[model samples]
Target: MLYRIFTDKEAFEEALYSYQTNLSIILAALLLMPFNYLMEVFKWQLSIKSLTYLPFKQATAGVLSGVSLGFVTPHAVGDYFAKIWSFSHEDRKKALGPILVARMSQMIPTLAFGAVAFIVFIQRKPVFDDYSSDYTSWLIPVAGLIAFLLLSFLFIKYGVKNKKWMYYFDLIRKLQLKSVAQLVALSSVRYFIFSVQFMLLLSIFSFPISFQQQFLGIAFMFLAKSVLPTFNFFNDLGIREFSAVLYFETFDISAAPVILASLLLWLINIALPALIGLFFVPQFKIDPS
Candidate 1:
């Protein structure tokens, strides 16, 4: 009986390996999505151009610095700080002013779309059939997202002028309104492009979900993965995959396809950038200011 049980376990393992291997191959093919990431870089450069007269190369460096730092740092704090650091070499206020406004602008559309999806979740069911489904239920995420937007906006608008939160709030007062508006528009474009990339990734999986369903699901998963607590230094690997599994359940998506889509996205969005940063690391030098 013991030998039979061991044999069964081994067979199960083999089947699992086979499934993962096949899925990985499909995902590998889809990793070409990185080519689309350039849209995000382009949008960021445009945002900077709206604010100040920057050379194309310098504006691009800001984007590169942001993306590289975003991958390495938890909660993207590193990316923001890196931007400030890079820009401070020229002018401290110039760097901090645009970065904060640009960050807020980017979050607006994400929070807005996520709010819609959250409401849909609340109307559906109280307890999620999946483990953490209830916790991830739409109401709280939507509320939190909305609250974050309000507070961030207020902070950027008023708090920046007042020293209530931190001296950093003063920086917001310095931002040019036209520049902020331009950044916000650029951010919206970035968000739309990202949604499009996910739609394409889903198509590669042959998932039957509609474009709205696909984008909404992808948005929720992306927000969850970005905000979720993680123990790893790199991307929140298992947490993100788990979120994908739960989010995809609404569309009757299978674990294999969800996993494939998630993996493909991670490889392109995070892995590829991180890998390139690795090559660029040797070239990274700290200039003594």
Candidate 2:
């Protein structure tokens, strides 16, 4: 069973090991790490500050710890668990508020960018040329998506009037429009940085793609990956490589190198932070009492 579970991983490692890489590209990619991480730390610090005050340094620790917890658990729900544990007993109970807002805020950029990316790929890309899905054909689904989002917002907006649903989403009630807007802006900056990093890495590996098409691929791949829920970090391993291979192949990029690039990205962005998070885990204290 364990061997079967790891079969996909074995394939990924084999490809990653066999691929040649540019040292300059690796160094350039590494340079984005601190800035990328700092953005997340900044966003988290600001979000949590709305509920409980935390200095930047401590917030960094919490964010990393959350990263680790998120890494091991599906959808990183453990992120919330680790966060609340970091607080005192009394605060632990209330900590869910900020954590919930922080998480949803993080998704704002993904949703916004993902929506655009989906449209771009569906319309402009050659692969989608025969897809039979055109911009006008896009209206119904887009309208449905918009309606869904609006309904979710309306629930959050007016749920306060009804006690049954209000308490559960109470934190959302405190999330004023201005604050949500700020979170979206902050998240957008982070999303742009991460997208650039992915492109840099792809170029480093010599992905055969034009700049415009490359972004179209990136948008769809990132959007698709985020749209699905992963059972574990490794669960998305196949998804990332497959998505990259599919999109890049439209431009004649080979699969092996693309898979390797995706692996390196996972190592850089997810695995490294998760390893760092392990150190902060010891500091987590849960006080259910």
Candidate 3:
């Protein structure tokens, strides 16, 4: 599976050779990765503010630590525990709920944009047209997707709960709308930054496709990667690379540049954070309290 997903080493080398030598694009993307983490740290700080007055420095530590631990765990849900490691013994138990609330809030933008990207993919890709010659036939799925996303976002925004639900999620139940909004906003901004970064990398590598084509492909690629669960970090990349090929090939975008861009993204965003996060991980001890 690894070989199949990440094959064509020669081709990737060629793509890297053409693009990586350009120092400017590489430097810009490398620089942007930290801002990406900073936005997330702020989002997390807001999420936990009501529960406890976690300092900005501590929050940054927690978020980066979570990133490192999350990289190894399935779906990175390990972050659920990793972020709370920094809190006081009493607050650690209470912190889980707000952390989950922050996570779900971020998911809203992913679902919304992902649904739109899927719609775009279906509309523009010839494969969809080939799958159904009738123009009206596609509307059924498109409309369904739009409706599903709308309902999903609505649920996220105003989901209901009774005392029973709150009983299990005591800290999470304390969540306020303002914090959720901040998280959603942060997540969206981070999404836009990375998506633009991917586009810039593609241009650097000279992927032969229009801006709209590249946008749609990367948008759907992210959507698919987020929704699909994976067992390990490498598996996460496998899913990303596979989706890139699936989405970009429709636009006649070659696998080489997309793969190289995906690799760069993983390196600067995932690998770097995870390594930086490791230094902070030792700052907290695991105390569930």
Error of 1 at 230 (Å): 3.6
Among the numbered candidates, top lDDT falls to 3
When 1 and 3 are scored with TM-score, the better candidate is 3
Reference-based lDDT, each prediction: 0.58, 0.67, 0.73
* lDDT of predicted model 1: 0.58
lDDT of 1 by residue, 157-201 (tens): 665544543444444555566656666666677677566655655
Whichever of 2 and 3 has more lDDT, that candidate is 3
- Writing each residue's lDDT as its tens digit, candidate 3 over 64-89 gives 88888988888787677778777675
RMSD list, candidates in order: 6.9, 4.7, 4.1
Instruction: Give lDDT for model 2.
Output: 0.67
RMSD of 2: 4.7
The C-alpha TM-scores of every prediction are 0.69, 0.80, 0.83
Clash counts for all predictions: 1, 0, 0
